[model samples]
Target: MADDRRLEVLSAIVTDYVRTREPVGSRALVERYRLGVSPATIRNDMAALEDEGYIHQPHTSAGRVPTEKGYRLFVDEVARIRPLSAPERAAISALLTGAVDLEQVVLRTVRVLAQLTGQLAVVEYPSLRLTSLRHLELVALAPARLLMVIITDTGRVEQRTITLMGDRPDPGDDGAHGVIDPVALERLKIRLNASLVGRRADDVAPALAGLAEQAPSDERALLAAVTGELIAALRPDAEERIAVAGTANLARATPDFTTMGPLLDAIEEQVVLLRLLSGDPADASGMRVSIGSENHEDALAEASVVTAGYGPGVGDAVAHLGIIGPTRMDYPATMAAVRAVARYLSRFLAGPQD
Candidate 1:
């Protein structure tokens, strides 16, 4: 266990350093924190902290900065999330309430987070397996060509077209388009339901055998298109992660041009960003904050992330929400806003009209 006074002093140093983006020294800490101890005593404690690898000096004579271990300890032991002010809360409510559709909600969420944190923000679309099948529509374009559309419980849409080849052209139905009888449409609906209903779209292969047995001539082509669309729609593309707002804010930090350029490139790499934010919730509820070097990626060494998991009302897939920002970010305010935003999203998506 860390000593109470020592932890207090360490927390103070971290908070101050994060705010100023400068190393914090014993004299400055004593002056600012009123630790009821002499500067020499604080210096000794600082030395001990450095020895324990919680803090380090950027140069021999420079003040100390928190190491990854230092940041982890501070977040786990001393961080306090402040609630948002009334005006801020009102602003958030207005932004969320104006969302006309699901896409708008997500896009607005990303923008709000970036605006608040001044760092890169990201919110991944919910995974497909968690979404229940709401509706499926099939339209016959010709005797053999068909178009299929599937809508999920989350309002995500997937569409595809299938083409079938036949040995004979049936030109009897008013032209060469052939016949699309009610029987064929009913059969197609049954095949779609069998393959997709109540099952994760990814697990529909075994069900395809039944479709093949009944519609052997066109089954393969139809299955291919349907399966392709389902997978494509459900999965997040590698490029999607980098599509974010607020890269300009990162420039305000005191990073050298070389460091800044690479950092920007790294942020544009969606795979790395997803991997960084991909951890499961640490506790049962509420929010989790990772500060500075506590992050796994070296590119995020100077940054911090605050995240949480939410769901849609009684039962739904856990939705991850949070902000990524410089370590100096206003934690209490950010955490409160993030929590509020997440709860609003849950309610908004679960409302009767949505």
Candidate 2:
């Protein structure tokens, strides 16, 4: 365990330096912060901290800045995250309560997170597969064709058409007789659902093929269309939609946004963003602060990330939420705001019980 007094002093120095964007010296710390010690005493503490590699002097003439180790200790031991103010909480609750759909929920979440943290915020949409199956409707358009509509708990809807074989002897235009009865159609729907319902689209085809051998002679086309459409709608090839807000904030903090062209380029890539966010689900519960030079990504080597995972719990991360900002960004405020937003988002996504 670190010394409480030292940790408190280090925390105070980090908090102060982040705000001023300048190195912190013993004299400034002593005079500015009531450390209950003289400049000389504080100077000795600073030297000891520097020797322990918790802080560093950027130049021989400079004061000191927190090193990555310093940040780690601060985050793990010294940081005290606070919830949002009641008014802010109420506003966030109202905004989230009005979300009629998942897209709106995620969009609003990213915006709210950005506003709170003053840093870039990214939110991944909840996967469709995880959503509860609300209802399924089947409509027969022709003897051989049927349309199937699937509604999810998240309020999103998908429709697909299934083609079935016709019992009509002519197999074509027979104006005199309408083939396929309502009873048969209902039975066919029941059969198809037995193999398809609640299962992922990709896994449905093989399951449906099992029932094909026993399918009604005239409903083969309808079955095929229903199965094909369901598969297409849930296809993993569909681009996972994610919402990003606060790039403007990112530009405002950095001194040379244009010069960091490569870094900006990587941030824009969806795959890269997804990989970065989803890289470690286990690290999601509390705030995980990656200071400059501590991040593994080459593009973000000079940047800092303060992130947390939000889901059912730490083990079942439903999604990721975090802020990306400069290393000099306010850690305490940013971290507090992030923790609040993450908890709020998790509650929003879980929604009220039906």
What C-alpha lDDT values do all the predictions have? 0.66, 0.70
Q: Which candidate number maximizes lDDT?
A: 2
Clashing pairs in 1: 82-332
What are the per-residue Cα lDDT tens digits for candidate 2 across 101-189? Answer: 66787788899889878888887765555544456678877764567877654454666666554344435432323344566567777
Candidate 2 similarity to native, TM-score: 0.78
TM-score of each: 0.78, 0.78
Candidate 1, which segments miss by more than 4 Å at Cα? Answer: 34-40, 59-61, 139-147, 161-199, 206-228, 231-243, 254-258, 286-298, 313-319
Q: Name model 2 segments beyond 4 Å from true.
A: 129-132, 136-151, 154-214, 225-238, 256-259, 283-287, 311-315
Compared with the true structure, model 1 gives a TM-score of 0.78
